[model samples]
Target: MTNLRFREDGSFRVLQMADIQDGPNVLPDTIRLIREAIRKADPDLVVFTGDQIRGYDPAYIDTFLRRRGEEPGARVRAVTEVEAKLRGIKRRARNRVNNRLLAMKSDGSNPDVQQTASTASTTSTLVYSTTSDPQDVPTTLDELMDETRDKVRRTFAGFLGPVIEAEVPFAATYGNHDFQCGILADEQDGIYREFPGCLNPVDSLEPGTFALPIEASDGSGRVAMSVMMVNSGDYAGKPEENDAQYPAYVVNPRGLDLADSDGYGTPSPEAIDWLGAVQSELGERNGDGKPVPAIAFQHIPPQEFYDCLKEVPAWTPNAVEGARTHAGHCYVLNHEICRPGSRLGEAIGCADENVGEVDALREAGGYFALFCGHDHKNAFVGHAHGIDLGYAPTCGFECYGPKSRYRGIRLFEFHESNPAGYVTRMLTWGDLVGRYSSNEVRVWFEDHCVTGAISMRNELRRPQVFAVLSGAMSLGFMAVIRSLVKKR
Candidate 1:
């Protein structure tokens, strides 16, 4: 474990990275963004907010093994132990896709729908090859499973390499997709702990729940402030069961239907109680019997995000849709309460159920800010009730983000004398690398495959692309309205 302390200058800087969400073959642009952010921030500690790996890849046999009630560790390494089960899962998934295509084809009246169905049917098995050399391809189910496990390890190393090389201590919290590929959160936690600079706790109220203490600058061993890290679990429940609680508003960046995605989860009650306990313990130990100041970090935002949002018309510029109880309406940061420099480009994908994190923190009395990262397109800080709720936009290029220029990291600086008066800023991609990169490439992973594309040099400048798209959409809408008026 790495001990966190204020620098000799009485200052500490933290770099937050969220949703790198890449696979074995990580994108070049993603690496560029991360390296540049690390260099520019020169943070004392790095925090990964989750979704480090794409867990939905078909090659992940561990997910299937776990679903079948089988252990996936080295003890169960025989191919025969899982070959039948893996084949069954694959067959069922393929059948479901083919059945849907058949149903669409049966309705020959809609030629457009039929055409789409046919195309999907033909490309159903076109998985992007993760291996560069044909000889590296696995020839057996056992080999495939081994390759998949290796891929997950490689993915972690690819992203964490920079922090490890920089000798900066780092901690992490898991996101919804992190465990989907077969490695459970606790298992992934083990992998994270193997690194040299990891600060993950060996014991906590829950896995991935721990605290980092910043020691006093005056050579006092007393804690000056505490950075609380909590896990915002995988999913509340299946989509069908919680549809009313978390309405799917927009398809995710990976193009997965929102309706099919599992709902986001919130911190467990024990985790909430753990925060209170930390507050009490710290107060007695160092704060002269007063609660120590703290700033919390989690993977998912609390429901209070809606409380700080003001609804607006769908057509309102820069407005994003609301989720869960506030679905069907568009919202922007309520400037009356939110600080300046806040931006919301997409809906808040909060948990289906309200776990009362905000209320708990408000009542606890010392937490000044809460920052999260599940929603990739939002980067804002809002003051609601008594605490500050904020999001650090995703720094990875593999997922849906605000344009290329806006994708970046968030940095927070704290002073030993006054921890509660800490300051933070967003170091965007445009700040480090130019808004447009000659090397900026389209990077994304699908449920079944991973593919990458590079745009022609300077062909798709971020601003011009969006401007043209907006103008074209407006003209098309106007033409449709005119035709309807003439018919009437």
Candidate 2:
């Protein structure tokens, strides 16, 4: 068994932020709230789950191009002119030969023929240039990448400052939105593949399961917290090669493709194998005699619970077009063979036989916590096998419609004494906190209080008594109603 130990004390704080897409006015407000939260929480580590910015919109692409002075229209026009000149030369050569042949056959007496021939040649050349050759469209993916990186850097700097400056060590999992190739091919090729800085620093560290030693409050104890960041996308033969099945597996309702060519999301099989090795190396050791608690962070949630239980429209005839039904969960099968299916389960590659990579981790036997942020909705703590899956809220903006509410983050604190377990709390911000109070300052404080209470209850379990009391009250009310109905 690998021994789990913290370099400092056992207690450490973690902040989970998700889905902060960029907008002019919305960005600043979101950033302010994030900065305030960081200051107030003073978390030891911050984890951004995914979707850092909305980079898919064509308008965003246009705006970025305009900013760089590489507008497509001008480039296209210039290329058009060049092509026209080349075509004009070829047309004039053909016309000269044709006129010579006509003159050779007609006698030298037709002066009108010369004028008509010249006019015909000019019109033909102009028509050929205009209709046959088109100008090349100009799009500098490299420039776009540079702009994106600068924007990301500025945004991150404003929120996180320099890592060294903040003196806070952090780790991140590449979300579906973070990896460019999966979202935009040109953007991925230029920014992510060619440019070194475009890739998130954390991505280069280690692909699989790893342990981070965090200090306890007294600084006398340390806790080795296991973190597994896996690629939920499809897999091809090798991690380096893009999977071919990526375009088929769709996770986002907004029609975002989260898979590479192999259909894996981010970490890839190379990363998955690396993670497996890390877990194997860690074994079962917990710092000081407790079991090591492992947390898996990813942009998307496991398909089994989130994807399977949720309601979706049915397209089949007689299925009640808009009726809701229980669908099996989705999972990644062999990365090489994912195909589109008739059902959602088949669509996500979660066939009946697929156990999923995450399941493999849970089966390996250590206290495991799965934290995700793609769903943008609150899920009651759910347990599958032995793993506890917790879905966190998005920090970027509010999720409107259905269960509409304000945006928030999840705060996780792990203690050294209990290495196998950790406390979790939800921190709401912006309009979410506003729903509770009209005063902005009061709302902030109140939101903090609510979060603090949840955290305390998670750790001590003392406040659960209130939950039990509430349940009992509801039960009593139901019993009285039943008795009164019987008497009547």
Candidate 3:
């Protein structure tokens, strides 16, 4: 329902940050990296594409503790630190219980915790008191589920607290893990709606799907670009619902309770239907008879993404170019045009299959490029039948990826004059971390510098080059040996 306007000069910058799972706790490093990217880009719009928090992922703790190396002691000590905190709490509890016990000792009088007591007799009573008064929220199984509603709010607040504080115009789509915390996408949308600039909240009776308009003054009033936001449903659903969209399920040959596909979500049939309805209601793109040039954002990548990858030109290591051109034709879509320029990182595909969703969206033709998140490793751009399939790189320190990995966000610069001809760049974590650590006057260089020098040495020395040096050194050594023999 909300349409963001472009600058009078027809420019809009969007920051696409994906999988910043800095949850259970706020990660200062992750925040620092993101803060730097935001400050550097100073984008007009921010889009967070799911997995903001690692809801109930206990394995993440072990992953974090061992991100650096195989040091068991270091890992154990890290865990012990938590244990130490728990022990401190236990000590407090032990003291509380002991103080009460001691105060009721038959040989003594009431022992005050503060040691400021002079009681009469040994017949003392032990009484327990609460530090916090009990109120509405209690802790039963059902209550815990209910508390998940509130817990998710806190989790999101911590993960996105900085963005909320910055008051940036932003929107979000859900990934499987987003609902792992017990808060549904719709409920979270309500909290986002309360914020200053949250567009396309799917928090309704329907999935949070909205077409945001981006208009610039033609010296008059006219909207130019329309950005569509869609929500891919969650991984956890009823068995019947799960079976309806996917080919395989738990009851298949594997007798498992939860299949791997169970953890994947996609834009539901209803969502695709809704997108079509919205396109019709929104009418022709700026009344040009053609649908307005638009960009769509979602969290889960559809199966069509796998088909798109076949055409992408191979890339070299390190440089990892953000853009690629492909002859777009793998899946059936409403439009069939070559897509150019992509930036790729760790490539991962949808956990579930896309049952005609791509064709359905293609039928609508409301969007030219689609952006997604779910797979944290993949950060590539591919073209499938005229639609730009963009995958934002994993942007969280706490997520499953390399520690020294180039985790960063994707930047999209939409020119009002060329809405479809937007340029994108992968803003690496190194780029932002560089800005942060740039001020240090330390003499030490990057860890790679040592390896770089070694590589250079190897490159500079050929077999012939080594042979010449070896020959000269051997002759000199022979001369030294002769001279020593003669002296002896």
Winner by TM-score: 1
- Model 1 regions more than 4 Å off: 58-146, 238-262, 438-488
Q: Which portions of model 3 show Cα errors greater than 4 Å?
A: 1-3, 58-138, 141-147, 202-205, 219-221, 236-263, 284-289, 311-347, 402-405, 435-488
TM-score ranking from best candidate downward: 1, 3, 2
lDDT of 2 by residue, 143-175 (tens): 434444565544445444433355555544445
Model 1, position 243: C-alpha lDDT score: 34
Q: What does candidate 3's lDDT look like per residue over 1-488, in tens digits? A: 45577877788889888888655555666677677778888777888877775643432221111111111111222322354455442111012233333323321334353443333233343222222434422222233334444555665666566676666688777766664444445656776676667775554435456667777746334567777777776553443444443334212312111342354556777777876666665565356555567788878777667654433222222221111121122212112322333433323445445566667668877577888887665666777765788788677765554333356788889998888889888787666675333222221221112222322233223344456778999999999999999999
Error of 2 at 331 (Å): 18
lDDT of 1 by residue, 344-417 (tens): 76668887788888888877877999999988878888888788888988777766566677788899999988
Worst 10-residue stretch by lDDT in candidate 3?
Answer: 65-74
Q: Which candidate is the best by lDDT?
A: 1
lDDT minimum window of 10 residues, candidate 2 = 317-326
How does each model score on TM-score?
0.74, 0.52, 0.62
